[model samples]
Target: MGTVNTVYWIFTIGLAILLLTAIIVLLFLWKNQGQLREENRKLRMSYDEIEKKYTGVHAEQLRYKLNPHLFRNALNAIQSHAYQSYYALDKLSGVLDYILYDTDGRLVTVKEEIEFARNFIEINRLKTSPLFDIRIKNKINEADPRCHQAVIAPLSFINPIENAFKHADLQSDNAFISVSFSFENDSWFVLQVANKTNDLPPSLNTRGGLGNDIYLDRLSSVYGVEGYSCKESINNGIFITELRIKIS
Candidate 1:
């Protein structure tokens, strides 16, 4: 009877030891899982930060490439036109000064943009009315003014506007550059510019230079291709560029 009691006691002790070991192993696994989850969360956050930085860098690069060219072109035009019989050079200098000094990635009010466009037209008028005729026509729905709200990317018009002045001839009174604005969908806006070019160099369509490729790259970088639309087509000896942007 004493031997049997001892054996039973030993078996009970061993069973308890095994049960404790199992509990300890389970606890270790749970702790490891928690640690893994925390590490994953931290990694995701790091990746997101890196992605944002990269996007900013890319946007800067795009702006950098275009800005220098814009400044140089504006200055050159001023210098070349200074001796000409027109007050446009003085006006151009003022417009360029305002455009270049403005901070990048800043949004200007719609009313401000309208003023810019008007100043732009006056400056062009000095060069010769035919090369670029800029007209701003608006049909505001006062019932819901927000729909006709005006907004534009900083220095956005410099490229296309300059192109109209430089590459296209405004020698003909009929050759007028027109920029019109309209609001739709109660939250979106459209800007359409029709430039009448008497003779567009075939090189304008070529890939490498200041052609569609360069324009497309700049546009994509600024607004993301999904945010804007640009289409170019020649009709009746005029090159028209139409851009539609979402205001919201």
Candidate 2:
């Protein structure tokens, strides 16, 4: 009977030790798991921060990828025309069509660009009086096949046009915006947009729009220094922006 009791006590003590060891192991594993979860949470927060910065920078780059003056001013001009005329909507569809579809390519034909410029100028005309000094001289031969074959980078020429109309001092009797396009020696093409300057009313105040320098930079980037040349001059309150490019 003494031996049996001793053996039973030994068995009970061994069982208790085993259970204690198991509890210790379980506690250690639970603590390790908690540490791993914390580390994972920290990594997630860091990734989110990186992703947010990347998104902001990407948004900024994409915004400037497009020349804001081209499409934004087109929309504004279209809306203005909506209030003024209904009969000319068909003729004015060029701006809408270009905005929606035609301006998808990296390069566009001289003819199509010229038509776009003409449409833009015509629509802007309704903004001012009939006596406004707005002039357009398109010397490139429209019927020539080269107009289609000789291509240039798209959106290169229209920024200056939008700039001119936006800052033009229409209050002055001598205020003028003139646009001219010509081909030199049939090898290089030229585009010039000029406008007068004067103090504008608070209602017409247009500040902080992209200017000639931006467009000039685009010209240089698209067509290296040898392929393109741009000049901007402010002569006696008249702003002139001229761009010349070798035909592609």
Candidate 3:
């Protein structure tokens, strides 16, 4: 009887030890799995951050790629009109040089931008007839030291001017486009573009056409939420765009 009792006790002790070891193993595996999951989550977050940065860089690269095509088209136009009007060709050449070289920079002086706008206007005038009335009122003198100090994003005013020309009715008797630039309180710079619209192309009438959306995106990237304001209105066959930037 004593021997049988000893054997039974040994068997029971061994079984208990086995069960304890199994439980410890299971706990260790659970802890290791949790750690692995946490590491995986961190890796995913890091990948997302890297993807976002790459996307932004890729988008900026695409935007700059457009510059070469624009330059080519402008040069072709200049070449076509070279012999017809020396004044127009000269203005177009200056504008092209600014766009190709000077405007490779992200920012430009207010004086430079104004000169670019004037050149663009003169080039457009050469394309239109006497029936079209284009008026430009620039209050900021380029010679003023203050004007030279003011700066803006390159090609900031050209988009609206292009849109105006794209939609204006040059054949109508009342066809007109007005462009004006002025300063308010010596702190805010304002650009206004208005045109009589009679026959707008279907493409430009769409929601995202004629590079308007791109212009707005560029503006938002350059100036945050409060730095600039843009207002557009369409009424009675007229289209108007106003841009206000706080330069100070």
Candidate 4:
């Protein structure tokens, strides 16, 4: 009877030891899993940050590529008026200064952008003869509290203006290009550019549309897809491009 009792006690003690070992193993596994999950989450966050930076850099690269084209056009305009007028050279100088210094920045004041557009249109006007009617109507009330302090992506309007000048029928009798800017509903900034198209080959009409695409890409990168909207239409030889941004 004594031997049986001893054996039963030993078996019970062994069983208890096995149960304790199993609990310890489970606890260690749970702790390790939690640590791994934390590390994985941190890694995902790091990846996201890196991706955002890369995308910003890529957008900047695309933006800079446009500078050379703009500079060339500005230089050509200055040369067109060489020895005849210095007004264009002066205007070109200001445009170059803005392009070189201010435009490298991600944003500029609405006033500055409007001024730049005006200067750009002036340069284009100088390039064309008096027969071409280039008109700019700026209805943005500088007195309006929103117009004074609002900021926008630099060179946003210049691309479409450039396209308008490039494809417009400047030599025709009724050649006209119009640019208008206004603040709508006190929350949205609207820009509209329309030009009469020339009777060009089908290929040329489609070829110069890439400038608008680049402009749209830059807008999307800066303001996001939901912050701005763009529309383009062609009717009766008139091509109109409109952009509206939620400024407030």
Candidate 5:
């Protein structure tokens, strides 16, 4: 063959080989891309299913956490006293009146909860006559009454507050009580009450009156898993107690 024709033939063969290689590479890439797209679709579906399951689980947890007795007591009290207004006794009765009567939902505001706690604390300090310093710092949320609002359990703190006073020592200066409330995240509402007890009285320590048992039972009934819990610690001749829960 002539030299020019031989070179042309070689060059043409090389070009054909290169074109074949490029076509093979393109085909392999297309197949791999299709598989990757399928995998991505499966992953997205799996993620969506997991998200839905988690939502259902969370909603179920909320349902279980919501105690029925808390609102039930408040509603029953109001229903029982629907015929009368006890405002007339406001002056004659002390904190006990608020504790017992206010359960009817007349003063069902958050402020009333603080007022009730204050009265209970005062009566307790008087009853125990704590020689040690007894202090109460209350921060109440004064909500607008014109707006419709939900209800909180009646006498929510009455038993627990009284229990603290009944069982806590009167001689220790660590007898401090504080109550505070705040709104959070535009959804979560919280109320916290804390107190230092003097010491557990014999009655409380021994469970003689079933006072502690009843107290815990009522808390369980009202708060379920969420209601009336205390974190108690002792330090330097002082005892501290804290209680926290979501109100709304």
Candidate 6:
């Protein structure tokens, strides 16, 4: 009986030591797990910051890519009509200011962007006349404070309109370019541009839609691929492009 008691005490002490060892191991694992979670959180935050910066950098690059195309057109119009009206130079200044200062890859107000498009239209009109079939419809309340606060990617609305002009069958009587801007809702801004396709020389016709590709890339970066909506179609000799963005 004495030997048995001694053996039982030894077994109990061994079990107690084993339990203590297991508890210590569990505590160590818990501490390391918490530290790992913290490290992972920090790494995720750093990755997001890097991604945002990369987006901004590439967005800026895309915006500037077409600045030269706009500049070339505006300067040509200003030079072609500089002798006829002093207004050409004034319009040129506005275009220059907008292109130089406002194209910083930041979100701009709806009013500012539409106004820039209007200014661009007027500048380009120096090349055409009242008889030209260029139609513009605007249905947004610019005075609303929300329109000012609601923002979208800069230079986002111009590509389709510019393409309409560039590819339009201007010499034909049936050629018409129509552009519209309106708010489908308080937070949704939409731009639609349609034009009759023109038959140009192979040189110009071969490179169609290159500008719009850049536009798409910029918007994809700004709003994500699925965040915004775009629809393009061609029917009965008319090419229509519509884009809708949810402003924040």
Best candidate (score: lDDT): 4
**Poorest stretch of ten by lDDT in candidate 2:** 55-64
Off by over 4 Å in 4: 1-67, 200-209
- Encode model 6's per-residue lDDT on 1-248: one tens digit a residue: 99999999999999999999999999999999999999989966855553454464465643545557676777787787657558877776876787778866555678888988888777777666558888889887778765776666677777777777777777788888888999876767889988887653323223345666667777787777655887777777788888998765
How many clashes in each candidate? 3, 0, 0, 0, 2, 0
Candidate 1 residues lying further than 4 Å off, grouped into runs, are 1-90, 129-134, 138-152, 199-204
lDDT of 1 by residue, 2-116 (tens): 9999999999999999999999999999999999999989966855553453354343533423445544655555566665525666566656655666435455445455456
For all candidates in order, the CA lDDT equals 0.60, 0.70, 0.73, 0.75, 0.49, 0.74
Q: Identify the runs in model 5 with alpha carbons over 4 angstroms from their true place.
A: 1-92, 104-107, 128-132, 143-150, 172-209, 226-230
TM-score of every prediction relative to native: 0.57, 0.61, 0.65, 0.70, 0.45, 0.68
Task: Please write out the lDDT profile of model 4 over residues 3-109, one tens digit for every residue.
Answer: 99999999999999999999999999999999999998996685565345435544473243464666677678678777645887777777778888877744556
Best candidate (score: TM-score): 4
Expressed as tens digits, the lDDT of each residue in 1-248 for candidate 2 is 99999999999999999999999999999999999999989966855653443242322221124455555555565577676565345435876676556655335678877887787687777767679999898887777767876766665666768767777898789999999999888778899988898853222222324454565566665566798886767777888878787874
Tens digits of per-residue lDDT for model 3, 1-248:
99999999999999999999999999999999999999989966855653443243333422222334444555565566666567876887888788678877445667888888888887776556655799999987766665776666678787778767666777888889999998888878899998887765333346237466777777777665687888888777788889987773
Models, CA RMSD each: 17.2, 19.9, 20.7, 17.9, 18.9, 16.9
Return the candidate ranking by lDDT, descending: 4, 6, 3, 2, 1, 5
Error of 2 at 36 (Å): 74
What residue pairs clash in candidate 2, if any at all?
Answer: none
Candidate 6 residue 143 Cα shift, in angstroms, is 2.5
Candidate 2's C-alpha lDDT? 0.70
Displacement of residue 209 (Cα, Å) in model 6 is: 3.7
Task: Compute the lDDT of residue 129 as modeled in candidate 4.
Answer: 88
RMSD of 4: 17.9
